[model samples]
Target: MDSLSYLNKYFLRYKKKLALGVLFILISNIAQVFIPIFLREGIDGIQQEVQYDKLFEYGLLIFVAAIIAGVFRFLIRQTIIVVSREIEYDLRQDFWAHIQKLSHRYFQNNSTGNIMAHATNDISAVRMYVGPAVMYSIDTVSKFIIIIAIMITISPLLTFYTLIPLPFLSYFVYQLSKKIHKKFTLIQESFSDLTTRAQENFAGIRVIKSYVREDGEIKNFTEQSEDYLNKTMDKVKIQALFQPILYTIAGLSVIIVVWAGGGMVIENLLTLGDISAFVIFLGMLIWPMIAFGWILNIIQQASASMKRLIKILHEELEIQDSKATRTIINSIKGRIEFKNVSFRYKNDLPDILDNISFSIEPGETIAIIGKTGSGKTTLLNLIPRLFDATNGDVLIDGYKIKEIPLKILRQNVGLVPQETFLFSDTLKNNILYGTKNGNDELVNHVAKISQLDKDVEGFPKGYETMLGERGITLSGGQKQRSCLARALAIDPKILILDDSFSSVDTNTEEEILKQLKEYMKDRTSIIVSHRISTVKDADKILVLHNGRIQEQGNHDELVSLGGIYADLHFKQLLEEELKELS
Candidate 1:
């Protein structure tokens, strides 16, 4: 119930349409109530004396009333149901926008399938409440009030007797509704799990095929499907009782009306027409009674879904521009400095990077070399503020990194991470992804610089070649080079390449590096790689060991030092000689 309060703003936004819908409900119900009156008059007039013209008048009046009611009923749906769809659109947009603003940590904690379930099933459930549940609630209330008032006008005693069973119906619905809400929450959770299983299976289909675990995966999915079916059956069993019990209660009221009103007619206290109208009014009340139960079912499901949505909407954004951010500092010259910075993903875990202090001048190319699990990538991530440092400060262009707006800071820095990801798009569009005004000229330039132009030219459609999902059509080295071209297309002032050349052969790697040497002459460049050949010619080299810099110098000086860098260099040289002999 509290979670449903989140929709108050949307209600206010569409209040005018809701008000018009209410007005239409009143008008429709008023017209519908008059049908019984005309029937009563016609029945009494026929008993008194047979007059064809009078009977025709009554029939015509009844027909007009029915037509009026039907028209307003259509108008009611036009206003109320239409507003529901509009609100659903707005809510979905808000959900998508909020998800985009959430930090990387949120994605790590949640699954893609769970989020997709929220976007599809959960949102549609809430829409049922916003549209159908709300519309029917008003319709049932207004119809009940109108029908009951007319019934009381016909005979106060009969109306009072028929309504005696209604209080019991209310109590029965209340108890079942509570159970329904709980069961619905469980069902929604199970649905999320089921959706996640299917999503993971699809995304990892290649892995399953590689391991030949199709039978095992199929068995697991079958188990999940059975679990979901059982939960749904449990909920359906509860709902199955709703209509039968509702009809039984409504039938009880009708019996009381017939028995009580028939006795009055026999005693000359009421006419035959009055008894007929009483029966008709009771029949109308049955629909409202059934609608009440259905509305409760929808409301319970919507409440459960809204609770799930609200939890995600309330997730705190870990990273955003703060009040201290400098709005005027729109660009940076790419002088990066790390002052005793240490970072850990969580406070309970050991630091991935510890006491890392380094500085890069505006136009120098600095290379970082370390074994796997060292903090080479983490150190570079701090420059672009991917993950904030746990202690100390990182400054860019002599300004604290946090002080710069994320948009401006990231726009000036181009990074090609170790894991290359490309969209299923045309080769030209993939290269031009982040640049707003990028033209063919810019795409061609970066492609040539990154040695991707040759591969694009070899394709049947050249730059227009459409890639498969995650660029699956390209070879490993082609994907890496394509990612490099994307980064270069942004025309960034600072370039960070995290092992971007691991897949390319030595000859191609040398060619790309030669091209980069001229392209990166004035831009600050940071390279993280395991290849000694890649970092040996940089202006300065930093060798990391166990989350700290072990050595810092040029290639010649590091070789003279006879330390970790020298040992790695010597090993790589021996491997190259062995490869040549082989």
Candidate 2:
């Protein structure tokens, strides 16, 4: 659907509040329209030598009308304007919720800064249009209808002359609104670029400083900011012409009324009170004319912004919960199998894994060892369905992995990636993040199993230490160990560690593995590592070579076979002996 149609759906949800606001506006205009009538009466009454008490009564009625108009005007804003804010809130919330449901591939292709711009600037623009623009447009049209009828009744010729410039004004507004919409779309695009550039600079500030390239980054950012400014100024120039042109049209109408109505009154064709009341009615049209131009500007900007938001909101979910998929709410046994699985990052790209078949029993521990690009990590990712295999099937407990509900499947599997990420929160909070209701006992248990407890004892605040962005406050090994503790705290039935011990010393790695052995009873564990010591004791070891499994067996059996696993083991043994000699 188009942007306007999409927004209308949200507007209709709060139509009751909007209708009440319009009613209040109509009542206020009616009250205001009576004031001019009373003024004409007071003047004619004085000219006819009416009683002082009667004139006082007309004056009193005028005051009452003004009060009623003011009160209803307040009510109009209270209802309609408040509803706009409520709709803005709902739109923002829904936008964020949709963003969260998007897959990892979506995030990989879109920048964080660009998404943030939609949430902030684009959403705010749409809100302004829905709120004030809508309110003022209704106010302007309703008041114009009532006041024009009254003016024509006072003097038809004068009213006809006053409306001559309105058609020209409408033509000008139509032409300019189209230009404004085009320029506003460009401006929003520029703003997104500026946001993306700024976010990149901030995130890579350390790299800039380390390489002494701060000046270069600043220059690039300045150029981006200037482009945004130029785009804004272009839109501003178009908007600046709008109000002045509207005022000129309105000014011409007033001039016509004064010139023609003055002659009528002098010739006794119209009374002094009648001419005075006609001008008062003409004055009411000024705001409506100006609002005509202003609302158009609002509409153009909102259209551009809503177009951008709709692009995201209407995006198809590439990975979704299938209707035929089973809902497994209970804990799943971690029996995993890969049948002739093959995967590529993109269809045109070369396969990262090809014709791979493997299986692990429910309580078995398996390890994957490979060169840097041999698909070790890709094979592990299939278990959690991070990216589905391009061909063939992945099964868990005799059922297709897709058959299990995503929430239940993920909850039972804990994965600690090579590149660890921790929130800028207390250490205790980070560990307990996966296990939302975890107590101290569970935290400590996982900490010891991951060998993270020893490091916490040296911290100033112990488990309460506040980490910096991405856990910058911790050392590399500390980050990895803490992440392990977090994953283990969830008590997952299937734990996958992808090079999780790369930063830790062999002694520490051995200690963590020993503790993990006890934790692995009745649970399946998949370890992806380069060090022979890390995976030498696994029940099965699979050596991957060039997108294919080269060998798979117990470590001793592979060593006896003198294959890729044997070669890796011998090379690692030489490196360790050299390290000891040094």
lDDT of 2 at 371: 93
Instruction: Indicate which candidate wins on TM-score.
Output: 1
lDDT (Cα atoms) of all candidates against the true structure: 0.89, 0.88
TM-scores for the candidates: 0.92, 0.91
Cα lDDT of model 2 by residue, 1-582, tens digit:
258668887899999999999999999999999998998888888888979898999999999999999999999999999999999999999899999888767888898778887999889889989899899999989998998898878888988988888767766786787788778778878877787778788888888899999889889889988988998898899989988987788788778878998899889887878877777777777767656876877787788889999999988776667985786546699999989999998888999999999999978999999999899988888887788889989999888888888878888999998789999999999999988699889888999998988899999788989997554399999999999999998889999999999999999999999989999988999999999999999999999999999999999999999988888899999998999999
- The CA lDDT at 521 in model 2 is 89
State each candidate's clash count: 0, 0
Write model 1 residue lDDT over 1-582, tens digit each, in one string: 778889989989999999999999999989998998899999999999999999999999999999999999999999999999999999999999999988877887798878888988889999999998998898899889888878878889988998888767766776777677678778878877787778788889999999999999989889888888888888889888977887788889888888988899899888999988877887777777666766887787789899999998898878889997999998889898989999998889999998988899988999999999998888887887778999989999999998999999999899998999888999899999989999999989999999988888788888888886554389999999999999998988899999999999888998998999899888899998999999988999999998998899999999999999999999999999999999
Candidate 1, residue 396: how far the Cα is off, in Å: 0.9
Cand. 1 Cα-lDDT = 0.89
- Backbone clash tally for model 1? 0
